[model samples]
Target: MRKITLSNGDTVEVECLSCALTSGLIESDGGVVIETDYLHAHQAVAYRIE
Candidate 1:
């Protein structure tokens, strides 16, 4: 897993691979299973919540 920040100053703890495959959880193969793009994630949730 890694920490990724967007231009809006929002941070997310995700696993990004090849700048395409991104996910909240790490996949079996160093790739991410993108469910929802970070562009939609709210600022409430973050790399380390509370």
Candidate 2:
């Protein structure tokens, strides 16, 4: 896990990029496209893909 400081001066613990994106801890351009108990999917932008 990793800890990050937000612009609002709050701290959050994150597991990984996918977890963060799925949990709404971070924002994605297209947002979450699909979510399930065992799976999650979302549209990936150019920067994210890179």
Best prediction by lDDT:
2
lDDT by residue (tens digit), candidate 1, 1-50: 77766434555565553232333332223222333534432322223343
Whole-model Cα lDDT per candidate?
A: 0.38, 0.65
The TM-score, computed over Cα atoms with residue i paired to residue i, of candidate 1 is 0.32
What candidate 2 gets wrong by more than 4 Å, as runs, is 1-15, 45-50
Q: What is the lDDT of residue 25 in candidate 1?
A: 36
Best by TM-score: 2
Name model 1 segments beyond 4 Å from true: 17-50
What TM-score would each prediction reach against the true structure? 0.32, 0.51
Query: How well does candidate 1 score on lDDT at residue 13?
Result: 63
- Clashing residue pairs in candidate 1 are none
